[model samples]
Target chain A: MVTPLEIIRKKRAEAVNRIVSKGYLSTIRVYVGMATCEIAAGSKEVMEVFRQAIANGLTDVYLSQKGCAGRCNLEPTVEVIEEGKIPVKYGRVTPEKAREIVERHLKKGEVITEWAI
Target chain B: MEDVQYKMMLCDGVSCIHNQSKELQSAIESELDKSGIRDAVSIHLSGCLGMCNKGPILIVNPGYTIYGGVGSEDVPEIVQSHLVEGKPVARLVIEEDHLYNRFFRIFGDVDFFGKQMRITLRNCGVIDPENIDDYLSVRGYEALAKVLCDMTPEQVVAEVKKSGLRGRGGAGFPTGLKWGFTAAQKADEKYVICNADEGDPGAFMDRSAIEGDPHTVIEGIIIGGYAVGATKGIVYIRAEYPLAIKRLEKAIEDAREHGFLGKDILGTDFSFDVEIRLGAGAFVCGEETALIHSIEGARGMPRPRPPYPSVSGLFGKPTLINNVETWANIPVIILDGGEWLSSIGTETSKGTKVFALAGKVHNTGLVEVPMGTTLREIVYDIGGGIPNGKKFKAVQTGGPSGGCLPEEYLDTQIDYESLAKAGSIMGSGGMIVIDEESCMVSLARFFIEFTQDESCGKCTPCREGTKRMLEILTRIVEGKGKAGDIEKLERLGSMIKKSSLCGLGQSAPNPVLSTIKNFREEYEEHIEQKKCRAGQCVALLSYVVNDECVGCGACKRICPTGAIEGTRKEKHLILDEKCIRCGQCYDVCKFEAINKV
Candidate 1:
C-alpha cells in the first residue's frame, strides 16, 4: 500500500504540475480581483467580456480570478501579465472598457496607459 | 488539452454566490455560444478574496485585466465589444486614486494590503476552497505529512512549545503546554476539539477562516490529535454559522477520501477521525470546560478547573481543546519552524492576530497584524481612522469579557501582556472603534446588558452580581443615578470578577470596571449633573427654546406634546412641565431655535 506520505506527495506534485503545465510562463495571463467587494463592483460582467472575446477566437490568453488585489475602491480590477513583462492593473472596470481593452491592448499588443492604474 | 485561447475565472465564495455569480456564469456561457466560439474559452471558480465588500469579480487573461461589480445585464455588451473587436474593455476598467498609484510605484502596489501580513489568511482568497486540488496545489496537507513521517509525537509537542504561541481565544494560555498535559496523561482514549463557538458580537474571524479554508482547521485538528495520541477529533462550532459549517463538512469529507483521516492515516499506526458538534449558541460555551460539557451532550456549564480539560475531559478521559484560531495556527507552526513564527511576534506572544475591525471606522473588515503592532496602526493606518472624521473616543476589545481602552491607549502595542496592562484582555479579536458622538456611560451600559443577558445563571457572582451591576448602569444612563451608584457598580464589578465561576462570570464585569477606570469623569457627570454630555440619553436631555428661536411653528407642529407656546414668527417658550423631552422640537427647528440642554 502506498504510504499516506507518498499519496500526499503524489497529489501535491500532480496539482503543482497541472498549474505549471497550464502555460503560466508561456501563455499571456489575465487576473481579475474577484473578492466579494470586486464582484459587488461588477467584476463578473467584466470577466464575461473576456470570456466573450476568447470565444470569438482570442487565443493563448489565460484568464483567472484572484482574491482582492487590496485596493477595494478599485474593485472590478483587471490585470495583464505577459511572459517576461511587468503586469499592468486597471481599476474600476466597466464592461465597455473591458471590450475596449480586448481590442486595443490584447489584440494590438499595446498598453492602454490612460486606463491602466 | 485543447489550445484554449482565453480563460476567465469567477468568484465562488459565499458572498459572490449570494450576488448571483452562478447566474452570471451561465449568462457568460450562453453569450459565448451566441458568438459560436464556446470551446475557445474556459471558466473556473476560485475562493474568496479578502475584498469581501466587492463581489462577483471576474478576471480575463492575456492582458491581465480585472473587472469589478460585473452584472449579468452587461454581459452581451462585453462579448460584442471585447471578444468580437479583439479589444479589451476600457470603459469597464476600475480606476484607483493617485496615492494608490504612487504606492504602486514605490512598493509595487500594496494598496489595502500594505500593512497586512497574511500568515493565517494565506490561502483564504487565493484558491478554490471546495476543490481539494486547489488546496493541494498550495501544499495544504504538507505539514501533517511531515509530522506523521518525520517527527515523533513528543517532538511535535516540543516544537509547538518552543513557538511561544499563546491561545488566540482570549486568555493567552500556552497551547503546547495544554497539548503536553493531555499527551502525558496515560488515558486509553484522548480527544482533540476545535472550538468554533465564537460568541463575541461583530466577530467573524473564525467564520471567515472556516469558510475560506476549512481544510486548514481540519488539518490542524488532525495534527493535534496525532501529537496528543488522540483518535477522535471534534469541531464544536456554533450553529449560527451555517455556511462555515457546510464548508467544513465538505472539507472533512474530502480529507477522509484522500486518506488524511480515518484508520492508519498517512500509512502510519496513527489513526484519527473527526466529527462535528453543533453548539446551541451559548456565550458561556466558549469556555473550555463548558465547551467540553456541550460536546458531551450536557447543559454546557463550566465546572471548577483543578481538573482542567487536559487532565479530565470527555467521557472521563483526557482531552485537548483549542479555539478555532489557535488550532488554525498549529499546522503553520509545524510547517514553518517554531522559530520562524517566534521571530515575527513579540517576545511573549508569537505570530499575528486576526481582528474583526467594526464600529465607527472607515475600513470595517477583518485585519491581521503582527504581534506588538500598535493600536494606532490598526485603527488609523489600516482602519482609516474613525468615520466622518469624528474624534475617536475609545476602542472596545475582547468582547464583553474584555475592557475598553481610551484614546491615550492607541499607541499601545497589541499583545497579551500589553493589552492586559492597559486594563483590557485580548478576547478573541473583536475590536470596536467608538467615536466622540457616542456616550461612554451608554457604551458601558450596552455591554453590561449583553453580558447580563447571556450570564447562563450558573453561579451567584455572575448571575446576581451582573444583574445588580446592570441595574446600576441602567439607572445612571437613564438620568436617575444617585451619588453612590458609581461606587456600588465598582464594588459589585470587582466582587464578581473575584468570585465568579468560569471565564464568562470572572471577566463579566470587565467592561464596567475598565470604563470606570478610564472614563470615570463621564460617569460622574452623568450622576452629579443629571446630564449626558454626548446627548445620547434621551431622559436626561431637555430641549429649551434659545434666543435664535423664530417661532416658525415647526417645533409647535412637530412636538407630540404641546410643549412649545408662541405665535408664528416670534420666539417660542418651551414649557418645562408639559415637555416630555422627546426632542421633536429640537429636530424640527429649522432656525436652530431649540437647543438640547
Candidate 2:
C-alpha cells in the first residue's frame, strides 16, 4: 500500500533523525547464559521468565542474554545493572525468583539483596 | 572504627555457588559477628578463580591468602588466625596449590593459567566486565594509544599481515588480507565494522566474549579504524543478544567519556567513533555484504559481490568488517607486536581460537585452544573426555556450514586449512561432539532444519535448495526414504554449495554432506532396512517393554495418553494402537526397562 517515494522519504528520515534525536535509551537488559553449560543448567526458563515479566510491564528493563561465564554449573543465571551500583549476577534464577526480581529489584531498586546476583 | 582489615573475597563462581554458597556466605557473616571481628575485616564475593572442583571458596586480601572447602565451621578459625593474628591459617590454607602461592606469595602466574593462551578470553575472570576501570587497569587502551600515536595505517596493516592472524568467525579468512583489501580503497569516509551476529547452534564463544569482556572488542575496533583509515565503526550485533548489545553500548559510552572513542582521541589528531546496529536474527545477515546492507537499513539479504564490502559497503563507503573474536585479537597483536603474537599456533593460523564445545563432551563450555591443536586434545584432555564413557563418533566443527570430522581425523591439527583439507571447515569454532548413539541422518536434518528456519530467503538456490535438502534428510530420518534419496541429497547439496550467493547458502549443505561421508553406514541402515540404528528418529521407532521392566505403574501414570497397558506389580507392555509414541513412558521406567525398536 506504500509508494516508493514514501518509502525513500522514510529511509531518509530514519538516517537523519537517528543522529539528531536520542531515542528511548532506557536499557531493559536481561542476561541468560545460553551456552551449553547454561542450557544444561536451565537458562532457557530464565530467559522465558524475563520475557514474560517484560511482557507484563513488571519493569522497563532491557532483556539481554550472554554466553557462559565459563562457570557452566550456574545455569539460568542473570545479571542486572541499573543507575548506580555494581551489576548484580543472580544465579539459578527460576521463574519464581525472576518474578520477585522484577517486582523488587527492577521496580524499586531496593535490590532483592538475597537474590541480587 | 575498630579495624576494616578482616577482608574476605568469596568465590561465588558457578561451581561453589551450587554447593550451598549462599549458606556459606551467611555462615561467614554470622561467625564474623560472633567473633566481633566483622569490623576488622570485610567480605567481597569475587568470580571463579578457575579451580572449579573444591570451592565454596574464600581468599583474604592484603596478604592475598587462599582457602578451599571452608564450610560454616571454618569461619571462626579464619577470623582468629588471619584477621586477629595476621598469620596464615595452616589447616584451611591452600599451600600446595600453585595458583594460590603465585596469587598470594608472588604477583604473577594467574592459577589455572599454565600452558593456555588467551586472546578471545582475555578479560574473563580477571577484570570485572562491567567496570571500565578494571579494563583500563589491565592496559586496555594502550593499544589504542599506540595505534593512534605511533603506528601509521599502513604500518598497522603490515603488522597484522606479518602476524598471519585469520578470522575466527568461521571462514578463517586472513585478517590482514581482508584489512588490506579495505585499506586499498581510497574512500572519503571509511568504516570499521564488527560482526557480532553469532547465530550458530551450540556456539556461544562470541556471546561470552561480548558479555564477559566487551571493551576488548571496542578497543580492537578502534584500532581497526586507525588501521583502515576509518572514522566510524559499527558493531552489527543480533537483536537476540541483549547482553552483548547492552555491554557494547556501555563500552561505547565509556570509551567516548574516556577520550578513547570520540573526536581527537587521547589528544591525537585522529578522530573515530562507533555506533551499534541490530540484526533481526537472520543467519545470512552474518555475511559481510548482508551485514552492510542491514546496517544501511536495507533488507538483510546478501547481494553478489565483486565490489565486496572492502570496495563498497554501508551506503557504499569503504569498510573493514571482522568478527568479534577477530577484533579481540587485534589489540593483543598490536600491543605485543606481530612477531611475539605470531609465536603461538600453526604458521597459517597464528593464534588461539575460542570454541563453544558442547554435546557429548564432558566439560561443555567455552574453551580457547591454540590453532592447530588436535581435536583429540580439545575433546579428551581439555574437555574431560565424553560423558557416560560412550565411544567417540564425530565432531561437527564450525556450524551447519561446517563438515563433520570422524574419529580418524581426531589427530588432525585444528586450523582453517587443515580442517578444510579434511573436508570440514574450521567454521566459527562450534565444536559439537557427537557420540556413538547419534544418528547421522537425524543430525543432518537437525542442522538443516535450523538453517532453513533462519534463511533470509533472498536467493533462489538457498531458499529452494535448502528446503529440498531438508525435506530429503527429514525423509531419511523418518524412515520414509527411498533408494535414490541419498543421491538426490548429494546433487542438491552440491548445487546449493556452488550456486548460493552468500556464505550461509554455500555452507548450508555441509551438514548433510559431511554426515553422509563419515557415517554412511548409519544412513544406509536407515534407508535400506527402514530402521534407525541410533533409535533417534522417532518415526522409525517403536517402544516395547523388555525383561528389564517392572510394572510399578510409574510409566503408565506418567504417560500423557493411555499408551502403556499392564497389570499391577507386573511387567508393562507398550500398546501399539493407544501408544502416541510421545516417549513419556520411556522416560519414566526406572530401569532401562523401555526399549525403542
TM-score of chain A of 2: 0.69
RMSD of each: 13.4, 12.3
Alpha-carbon interface RMSD of model 1? 9.0
User: Can you give the lDDT of residue B59 in candidate 1?
Assistant: 55
Cα deviation of B137 in candidate 2 (Å)?
0.3
Interface RMSD of each: 9.0, 14.8
lDDT of 1 by residue, B20-136 (tens): 889999999999999987887766554333233456677564444556678998788777776666577776655422111111221122333445656676666555466677688
Residue B244, candidate 2: how far off, in angstroms? 1.6
Lowest summed lDDT window (length 10), candidate 1 chain B: B98-107
Per-residue accuracy of model 2 over B269-371 as CA lDDT, tens digit each: 7889999988898888888888888888888888898888888888898889999999988887887767656765676877788887888876666677677
Evaluated on the second chain alone, the candidates' TM-scores are 0.80, 0.81
The TM-score values for the models, in the order shown, are: 0.76, 0.72
Best by DockQ: 1
DockQ of all candidate complexes: 0.13, 0.08
